[model samples]
Each structure stands twice: as structure tokens, then as C-alpha cells.
Target: MTSLFDPLALGDLTLKNRLIMAPLTRMRSQQPGNVPWELNAEYYAQRASAGLIISEATQIAPLGQGYPGTPGIHTGEQVAGWRQVTDAVHRAEGLIFLQLWHVGRISHSSFHPDEGLPVAPSAVKPSGEVLIADWTMAPYETPRALETVEIPEVIAEYAAAARRAKEAGFDGVEVHGANGYLLDQFLQDGSNRRTDAYGGSIENRARLLLEVVDAVVGVWGRERVGVRLSPYGTFNDMHDSDPVALFTHVLGKLSDRGIAYVHMIEPRATSAGGGDTVQEGVPCSSELFHPLFDGVFISAGGYDRDGALEAVASGRADAIAFGRAFIANPDLPERLQKNAPLNPYDRSTFYGGDARGYTDYPALG
Candidate 1:
């Protein structure tokens, strides 16, 4: 039987342990474009002790951006900034994966090109809110529906971004197809209404996300790729009547991809924003998300050591991911192994800030 600190092989990437650093958006990048900076290098390096670290969600294109201070992989400067971060982690023997993200309509027009409305699968408006900048909470901009001709462009953009992530020094990339983003919007009928080949049927709606995975796999090969999904999450005004049916069909498509792993956030778990919302017009529980994917599964949300052990022992997941714990405990793997007390994360400085709630967290002595 494998233990929490057991050596694990995630395709071409071999890890010293199975405790993964769940992708958390701290929004520490530069403004106007979310370009990375020296401070980001320091933040990631401090947490380099993890077996694997999935860096924060990075926008694949300008219109894909949602919140301020999040990183982007579209430009030369951003790539250069991330190179330093990757180099720092590598020097400490840490393997990192960059998450490719498209926030869809979970954005404000203020952050877009010419301050225009953000785009989504359809023109439908979603309930709920998002934090923009310091002291700014706005209603998600009413999104404009994408034309059929524009679908392939977004797919290609994700491919280009995956190439950029490789060029930027990441060992691999994770496609962000969850948490009510563009991909999830397409997967769920509540936020999508298209008569084209890209909507209506499960296979049609799953087209965009699978295309994204295929394109990234083409660039990075299946072994160096991964995908993140929140089947039970009701985030960003997202919902699906039959999530199990949707993912079961989708996961069947990924069965032969030879990808590294599938990282899942349980639906009813307390998300970064708070509790799970799988009600009417809300996304359902993610606790039963394990059977969707065929490869290695990494489960996350509200897990401690005992819980993680149980999941692995029960054959539910290959690994466990922690968000807040990683923020407050950079040496999380070490702390877990030693049975040491862990620090708490400060919620105030989670997005857009200096080093206070970032690198200042101490390790166990």
C-alpha cells in the first residue's frame, strides 16, 4: 500500500510524495495585465517543498482574464517573469504545473480590451459576484455570446498558451475546465444555449473542453498534461442538472489520453469563496467525483492528514490537495510527516498584495 509520503509517478513526472499543492489564485502579479514579478518568484520558491505545485490559474488570452492581479501567459514579459519562478522551484527540486485558465464572464468590462463586456458560451447572465481589485466587488459583466466561427480560435489559443507555459519553464500544464469558467459554462446548460454543433447534446458541449485537452496534449504530450474540474461546484453562477452523466461521458473520452492526472474539487466542500452551492440552478455536490476520470485522481477541499489517508486507503484518490493549508504551511509535506502543528492562512491578503500573507508563513522548527 502507498503512503502519503510515498514516491509517486505522475506520467513523466516523478514526485517524492503525493501531497499536491492545489492551485490557489493569490493575484500577486502586476496590474493592467497580470504579468508576473520578482515577488511571485519568491512566493513559489518558499513553498517548493511540495511534491508537486500547480501554480495559480493563468489566463490564456486577454478576454479570458477575469480578476485583477492574476497572471497571464500571453506575452514575452509574462513568460520571462515565470521563468524565474520556475527556475527557483526547480533549484529546490520541486516540479510545478501551470494552470491554463479562461475566466469567461466571471469578469468585469473594466479589465477587458477597450473595457468591453467579457465573453461566455451564451448571453445568459449568472448570479453571484467576483472581486475585481482592491475594495471592488462588481456584478459579473453580462457576457456576449461567442459566434460559432470563434470557437476554434479559443481552442487554438489554449494550445498556444500551453506552448507558452512550456516555454516559460513549467514542467507541465493543467487545463482549468472547472469552477464556472468558459469550459464549465459550455458543459452546463444553465449557462449555455447554442443550436450549433458546440451545444445541446452532451458530446457537443463537451467538444470545447476535450478540444482544449487534446490541443494541450498535442503540444506537451499526454504524460505532461492534466485537467482540473469541479463537478459539484456552483461557482460563478454555474449549474448542471446531471453532472454525473456529464462527467462520466467526458471522462470516457479521456480514458486513453495517457495524461498525468485529474485534479478534482469536491462540490459540497467549502470553496475559496465559502460553502458548496449545489441547489436549484446551482452546481451539485462533488463528493462523488472520483469515478469520472480513468487515470490518477487528486481530490481536494477541506482535507487534513487523516482525511487524506482515508481517501487514499479507501481507493478514492491517488493524492490529496490542500489550498489554505499550503498558504499557511509552506513546508506542508514535512509538517504532515512529522505530525506537527500547522499555521493558519490570512484570508485578507489572498488576492493582490505584497508579502504579508504570502511568504511570511514560517515552517516548523
Candidate 2:
């Protein structure tokens, strides 16, 4: 039996186990630039027991900032701040990857640098709400659409961010293409209505994501790069007319490039809540996407220990990512190794908060 604790070689890095720390969006950073701090370092270091840690979604540039207090990697301060995190995690014998993010239209003027309009593939308003700096709930605002000429710059930002992540001491970098972000915004036809080199066709719509992969892989090498994609999802008003085709074409692209891994959200994974496989919003079906990606596959969303085991046992996935469960249980692999019960996460503190729910969750003796 291939246990979750088995060492697995994912590209250049060999993980101690299969339990991956999902890239969560915890809007906790210093203001002005949302630069990372010592606290961020401590939080990540504490969770170092996980086989691999994908740090919280960090904005690539100033325009990429979606929420206040979320970290940024576009500058020197943030990179220096993150070095502490990587150093700390390494000290604890952990492998960590940085998740580069751009929220696209899932933003409010309150979160923007100039408080002007936010950007997306189109000016679509997100269906649900968003939490701001004060941790106040508010409706999402309509965002300005990105012009065709502006796309190359965005792709360059992802590449530059990946370079910064590597310079900042990250083991690898995962492109945040999932959860209704900029890449998902374009992949999903419901929001992306562009009629340019970057839209209308699946190949065209996939241009940015591919370009991003090219750029990041160029800097970090294919062995140190990964990408996340969420199909059939409803978050941030994202849905594609034919997600399978869009991603299958993408699968061919990923195949050609030799990316380190593809961290995909399975049919029932959510960005929030414990990884328990909840069926909601088209269920993010991955049956169509699985066959396409021929790399180290790490599936997350909603998966408990047993479900994760099933995924690997059935030969469907190589590894599994645990979000909330890993959040509450720092020594998650050890707990699962010993078949210990996990501590329940406090939902109220899932967003912006201190160490209470962030790092205060105890590791069993």
C-alpha cells in the first residue's frame, strides 16, 4: 500500500510525504506594500512538518494586489521578508513553494493601489462578496477589462514574480491559475469576452497562462515550476463553456513544457473549508482534466485523509493537498501517520487574523 507518508519525488524536490500545504489567501502582511513580515515567517515555519508547503497567494505586482495585507513579491522588502520564511522552514526540515497570485476582477476599489477600477479579462462583477483590510464583508465591484496590449505585461509580472520567489529562497513556485483568479477569469468564457490574440479561441484564451508558464519556467527551470487550475468552478463568477477542451489543450501545452507538477482541484474541492470534498458550484469536476496532465499531480479542494488515500490508491492522483485540515493540524502528516483525529478549524478566523487560528492550533504530543 502506498501510504501518505511515503516519500515522493516531485520533480527536483523529493517530498517527505504526500500531504501538501495548500496555498491559502490569508490577508496578513504589512500595509503600504503588503510586504511580508516576521510573523508570516513564524506562521509558515510552524507548519513546516507538512511534506511541502505552498505559501499563501502572493500578489506579483502592485496592480495584482486584490486584498489589503496580502503579501507582495514585486519589491525588495517583500523578498527579504519571505527569505526569513524560507530560512525558517528550511531550518525545520521543510520544503516550501511560493504561490504567485493575481486576483483579476475579484477586487474592490478599497483594495486597489489608487482606489481606481480593478482589472480583469472583462468588466464582469463577481457573484459573491469579498473581505477587505478591516475584515469587513462587502460586495465585489465591477472591474475594468484588460486590453490586449496590456497582457504581455501581466505575463511578464508572473515571470518576474517567480524570479523573485526563487531569489527569496522558495523551493519552487506554483502559478495561481485557479480559484477564479486572472488565469481562471480568462479560461472561463462566462467572464472573458475578449476578441483578441488572448481570447475567442481556447488556444487564444490560454495564451496568458502558457506565456506565464513559459516565463516562470524560463527563470526557475521546468523542474521548479508548477501551475494550479480550477475548472467547473463558480467562485468569482467563473465558468467555461467547455472547460475540458480549454484544459486539454492546456494539458498538451504543459506536456510540451515539462512543468514540475500540476496542482489541480478535484471535482469537489473548495478554496475554503476543510479539505472534505464538498459538492457545490458544478463541483469543479476534474475527470476531464486528469487525463491531460502528465506530470506530478497534486489534487486539492476538499479531501479528507481517507479520500486522499483513495485518490492515490486508485491511481487517479500522485499526491493530495490538504487546506483547512493542514491549517488546523500543523503536524498533519504525523497525525495521519498515527491515525490521530485532527483539530477542527475555527471558520471565523479563516480570513484576516492573528495566530489564534493561524498558528495557535496545537500539534499533538
Error of 2 at 118 (Å): 0.8
Across 1-365, the per-residue lDDT of candidate 2 in tens digits comes to 77677888888789998889998877778766788888788888888988899999998976677776889999999999899999999999999999999888876677654747779998888887877656688888788999888888888888889889989999999988888888888877888888888889998888888898899999999998999987666665677888778888887899788898988876565544433448765544445566777788888877888888887777677788988887788888888888899999877777676777887889997
Q: Name every residue pair that clashes in candidate 1.
A: 232-267, 267-286
Q: Which 10 residues in a row give candidate 2 its minimum summed lDDT?
A: 268-277
- Candidate 1 RMSD computed on C-alpha atoms after optimal superposition onto the true structure: 2.6
In Å, residue 77's CA in model 1 sits off its true spot by 0.2
Cα shift from native, residue 23, model 2 (Å):
0.7
Best by lDDT: 1
Tens digit of lDDT per residue, candidate 1, span 1-365?
Answer: 67878878898878889899999898889765578888888888888888799999999988888878889999988998899999999988899999999988886776765848888889988887767655388776689999999988999999999989999999999999888889989998888898898899999999899998999999999998888888867767777888788888777787667688888886646354454332233333334656656677888777788988777777788888888889889899999999899897777877767989998999887
In model 1, where do residues sit more than 4 Å from their true spots? Answer: 133-135, 273-289
Clashes of 2: 7
| Per-residue error (Å), model 2, residue 242 | 1.2
Candidate 2 global TM-score: 0.94
